[model samples]
Target: MLRPMGREDMRAGDSDRKTVADQLKTALDEGRLDLSEYDDRLQRTYAAKTYADLDGLLTDLPGTVPVQRAQVQPHTPAAAPAPQTASPARQIAQWAGPYGAVIVVCVLIWAITSASAGHLTYFWPVWMLIPLVFGVCGQWFGKGGPHRR
Candidate 1:
């Protein structure tokens, strides 16, 4: 019969080393270890050959429970509720709000310039408005539009 696996003699892998490295990084971020100490521990973590070695590095830290086999639970089936689609008006409002703000700001600048410069010049804001209008229209009518959701 096969025996249960034990942690002490388990071989450490690259992912295990990376997990330890990430924990060390978090500790360094939280002021638990200085740069030099963190660097030293990180190097040792990558060099660790077995689970025991990895466990030793984290022994002083809180919440570092040794890895164990996950307990399996019985599976059950329950249908999840379907996601509700946004109303066409809601989607239009969402897409329009930012674009509307950009158009407004551009028009305000153009108007202020025209007033200062004695007369209305080229309707330069139309350049900004055209592409935004096209995008909004595309989003409203395209195959991948929000309404399709």
Candidate 2:
């Protein structure tokens, strides 16, 4: 038989802290908390060590629920972890894949135009290529890309 949860005596874990933090963020987003107050409460939420402590922080927030520690059953393995977002390199590759095709098409068009004109035109393709190169370099080096929230 399992014992009932007694909130006062229960210890909080990382997940519990994260849950309350998420709720606090929602409250902040909803304009319930100003910047300073939200920052203070967020700090306190992470510092909370017990379920009772977490409960106190959320008492004033609507729809907030007390954190409950997850229960484990014997003979069952834990569920697989959630899929991770693609890494920066993977994201860059994915973006580059189609963009590379576009560049190839642009080069083909430039080649056809030059061959028909019987002389090389000014490298107009460099206009397209310059920005693309800079953008990719920015994604590679600038703050780890804009996809990061």
Candidate 3:
């Protein structure tokens, strides 16, 4: 049996239930609760038919998320055309465009040596031109490159 104080607490709990029922009814009347939600809540509150049942009616609803996920995924942007880049161009452009003096030197070495000896091997430095083109194109098409946040 509950103590006298426990009896008082039980009465208070009953009063709280009445308050909740009244609030739910008011929400239904005021059109705050949709017809479906109001009907569902009413079913719970009334069909419970006992203290334990009523207590179980409002289960795990407050402050609960709809779904659970171990980790949030980083938003990857949609795929683009084959040539589009995900990074800005100014960076590599600096090395390929403004700092392309090294390419010029290599070319000169290959040019001066090609006529005298075959060791100039201009093809070695030719590979640098690929990245250079990419950097320049990046500067052109990279206008809105890479997503912001």
How many angstroms is residue 92 displaced in model 2 relative to the true structure, after the best TM-score fit? Answer: 27
- Pairs that collide in candidate 2 are none
Candidate 2 on 116-140: residue-level lDDT in tens? 9999987777777876788689877
Off by over 4 Å in 1: 1-6, 25-44, 68-82, 144-149
Q: Would you give me the overall lDDT of model 1?
A: 0.83
Name the 10 consecutive residues with the lowest summed lDDT in model 3: 61-70
lDDT of 3: 0.60
TM-score: the better of candidates 1 and 3: 1
* Predicted model with the maximum TM-score: 1
Would you list the C-alpha lDDT of every candidate in the order shown? 0.83, 0.82, 0.60
Ranking by lDDT: 1, 2, 3
Question: Each prediction's TM-score against the native?
Answer: 0.65, 0.42, 0.30
Q: State which candidate, 2 or 3, has the greater lDDT.
A: 2
Candidate 3 runs further than 4 Å off: 1-95, 118-122, 144-149
lDDT of 1 by residue, 111-138 (tens): 9999999999888989987877787687
Clashes of each: 0, 0, 0
Measured with C-alpha atoms, the lDDT of residue 86 in candidate 1 is 72
